[model samples]
Target: MRSIISFLTMIMLSGCGDGVTLYPAKGTILLENGNPVTQGTIECESVDNPKKLNASASIQKDGSFELETMGNKGIVAGRHKVTLIGPAGNSDLPLNKQPKPQFNTKYRSYDTSDLTITISPNATNNLNLKVVPAK
Candidate 1:
């Protein structure tokens, strides 16, 4: 069981002095072709309770990210619906110079994404997830 509880967008932090330590979850995001996803945000939402505060992270240039819950970086012990939204690409560019969507709409939300992740009470959870572009 997780020591933390999340409701709506509110996060409550707790811990067990009995010895179970909850650690943060980290992962790397990559395109199906094995290239790094330069910019974007990743989400990890509780499966049973969609309203629970969702854990989110900024996708780094190396395609890596760490999930944050209750102000700390980690999720409670349970299943999570993972979602990734790639940056619109070249956001720094002029409006007309922005690039098209790098991935399909399905990759943008937990409800539509096929990605699911499980978090444990381990010291570290490093998931290597992959995303693909749709035709």
Candidate 2:
């Protein structure tokens, strides 16, 4: 009935119009020297809401990655500051330990990383980004 349809529409709109939307994004990560980065996690913090949202993905053996925002499929739609935390080849470390990152510390934070990305809604978001050894 029209009444039922209207109610359902209202429910859907309310959930989706909260000003945050995610978009599928995947890419390959290479080192500043042009080598494929074989292992590590790529994190993209939503410049719009850094304290609460982050999208991350693990680098595959071939260096390709598929990002997920807050465990959902895709990255948050907006500008983001990216960070590479590195060479974790595998998640084999104990909960209390972390693999040593090959890159320097300066590349780990938004303020320090010179890397940034912009993601728009409803677009094919496949993009590649390179990480450099911290200076």
Candidate 3:
């Protein structure tokens, strides 16, 4: 029926939106001691978006990452405030349960991290970020 066909069309187009272009973003995160962060996530909150849309990428063992926004393959173009979440600590637990050391506290929050980057279209957004090691 016509109604059934129309419903199927809408569903197919739901994932498509205002045609906003996203730029590819990739990076590596390092500690001041020149070591790579082994695990966790890196988030980039769009500073110019009222909706506060963010792009995030999981930190790989080599400290490398690639950003994705809302299930897409890239990030929205703009200035972004970067925050890093290191592996959770289980130090209080049994010795075997303790996690590898995390990054400095200041890099865990956007307000205190003091890390920002501008993402531009048609340009390679490869970045290298360094944080202080946990004390």
Candidate 4:
């Protein structure tokens, strides 16, 4: 009886580690003229419950990016709305006062007004977004 109880306890503890992991979702942004965009900011938000999850990352000089939110500080395992705010190139503006710039590749303003994504526990996931130029 004692051995059986101990075995069951171990099994239960193992199940507690279920969670999602995401990879370095990297991609490039370009202007409508076919020029590579070298500056911007990317952010992730939850679609189901907007206030539940949020994450962001800064674009690199080569137009590549990677974002990670893990160890209980990352997004929960589920769907999310991904949004990108291109760079305005204004260094004097306050952080809170800056507006989200539009992507200039395909002429679209943002990546997804209602983008959906899923996060799996104890795993790594990668995603890419190509933003178009604003009309």
| Local accuracy of candidate 2 as per-residue lDDT tens digits, 1-135 | 999999999976663345667788998877778777777788888787645578899888677999886566787778888888875434686755765665667667778888788887878888788766545
Sorted by lDDT (best first), the order is: 3, 2, 1, 4
Strongest candidate by lDDT:
3
**TM-score-based ranking, best first?**
3, 1, 2, 4
Where does the lowest 10-residue lDDT sum fall in candidate 1? 8-17
Query: What is the C-alpha local distance difference test score of each model?
Result: 0.73, 0.76, 0.85, 0.56
Off by over 4 Å in 4: 1-36, 48-51, 70-74, 88-114
Residue 25 lDDT in model 2?
92
Give stretches of model 2 more than 4 Å off.
1-19, 50-52, 88-104
> lDDT by residue for model 3 over 1-135, one digit each (tens)?
999999999976664256667889999999888899889899999998666778998999999999998777788888999998877666579978877556887878899998898898878999899888888
Query: Per-residue lDDT of 1-135 in model 4, one digit per residue for the tens?
Result: 999999999876553243433333445555556655566766666555434556666777666666545322345556666666666645788888775555633222225354455665555655545556555
Task: Give the alpha carbon lDDT tens digit for every residue of 1-135 in model 1.
Answer: 243333422432343223333468888988889987777788887775445557888888898898886566677667888877666566579988875555567977777899988887754688898888645
Clashes of 3: 0
Q: Runs in model 1 with CA error above 4 Å?
A: 1-22, 49-51, 88-93
